[model samples]
Target: MQDYLKPTEIIDWQHPQVLSLARDLAGDRADSTAIAKICFEWVRDEIRHSCDYRLNPVTCRASDVLEFRTGYCFAKSHLLAALLRANGIPAGFCYQRLSINDDGAPYSLHGFNAVYLPEWGWYRVDARGNKLGVNAKFVPPEECLAYQPRLPGECDFPEIFPEPLAVVIEALQAHQTWDGLLKNLPDRVSVLNS
Candidate 1:
């Protein structure tokens, strides 16, 4: 609990600028779903999507993305998932393969998030900023969870996770560097926002 309270991780919880926000926001949420919903709203609406910081992949942390104010989808997932975890909601990463109409990158896959909703079970959400860096137009609907990523056999998730993740798993299986597998999309929003 103390670890998340550090000035760095606070942004991952919610809007850092709000006065007297925590006691009210995190204190009385009716259920885990509600808390997760608020978290979804904040990340969904407030954080802008960009590819900038994600290039290295390893540097991602909820604290870094929230404090710096920009990140790729995975960073956004980390931020939201960390907040959900901090708030006592069990959450984890869920991703899928999505190739661009025109292939240009290394892997033909995309990443998103999945949260344990208790009564409703685990659900999905995409926090990636718009492909063109437009945050306003990309709002995730509740139905997005219908599209889920493959889960690992070791993972507590109900389904099986796919190949892009398999490349990561194989490297991990070989005791190779897991950090090399992640992609940092790109971003300039954090700079301009700051």
Candidate 2:
């Protein structure tokens, strides 16, 4: 969809660095699926997750995420979307509400991307950077996201947003450090009720 391909303040796929990286990643690959996989893996492996690495200067926009090479899960999604859109592939944002500690009580939004593939339609992928227990891959028609909703409060959101949620952007902009963002991670119920 044109809506998913268009650049925005958060997606910012038209930025020089993003454009260049997309071009570099796509590199002589004519297949959209292949190009999409390359871009997804790059973001998933190359970019550092803020909380996992305890990195600072929280980033929101796609350019800033790529520039700093670090971002929260939501911010990382922005970069992945930008990269896919840069290559003329349609991409959009998706979210999941999960227990912060895999226990109950605290639940927050986890963000990832859904890319439109010609044969498989829109497929969801998580570029949140893999760790010891987490592994996300780009296998079409079969999603392998980093985290699944297992707790009672946790749920997988069905909508694919053309733009990053306002709450996500606001939280990223408001927090200046990894701990700050972690303490105040955005929740989905608030967004739904409002």
Candidate 3:
């Protein structure tokens, strides 16, 4: 739980801008759930999905995502987690393996957040930035993620990580552009077991 709330190099909740924004989002809300929902919606609606918009720089860290106003799904999750953690709520990362083409093969990891609400314990939310055919909401006890794992090799990973996976960070850092990141997205979850 402490790990979930702690700022890291990637999560970076302690960063000045992130901290200020977190306070702004919370904005007189005393309930953890309300704060979480506000933070979740802010990231989902305010931040642009890098690949979806074809934006550049391939941000990984939370602060970078907020600064750029655009990021891939993984980077967006980082910002959401940071905002939640900054507001004194625990948040963790979750992933799903899905076919990039929605058919088969070329499966890549999709990242999102699982926040610990006092009433619901742990709840997952996807801040991947909604578009036509993709809607992710912060309704506790009932998840409405951007995509479902329906394809042959797709799966919803059970573990909730305190920080973004190393592979995800690596991919974001390695790729300089949104298109590059899209082409070389990380696919393996075996590292989680290792």
Name the candidate that leads on lDDT: 3
Alpha carbon lDDT of each predicted model: 0.47, 0.93, 0.94
TM-score of each: 0.55, 0.97, 0.98
The whole-model C-alpha lDDT of candidate 3 against the native structure comes to 0.94
Each candidate's clash count: 12, 0, 0
Which ten contiguous residues of candidate 3 have the minimum total lDDT? 185-194
**Of the candidates numbered 1 and 3, which has the greater TM-score value?**
3
Candidate 3 Cα errors over 4 Å, as ranges: none
Q: Give the better candidate number (1 or 2) by lDDT.
A: 2
Give the runs in model 1 whose Cα sits over 4 Å from its true position: 1-27, 52-59, 101-106, 130-142, 145-194
lDDT of 1 by residue, 51-170 (tens): 333332232556655655655565566677667656666665655543222343333344456666657765666666544433322223344432332333111233322111333223
lDDT of 1: 0.47
Q: Tell me the tens digit of each residue's lDDT in model 3 across 1-194.
A: 89999989999999999999999999998999999999999999999999889998899999999999999999999999999999999999999999999889989999999999999999999999999999889888999999999978999999999989999999999999999888999998797666
Question: After TM-score superposition, what is the CA distance of residue 106 in candidate 1 from its true location, in Å?
Answer: 5.8
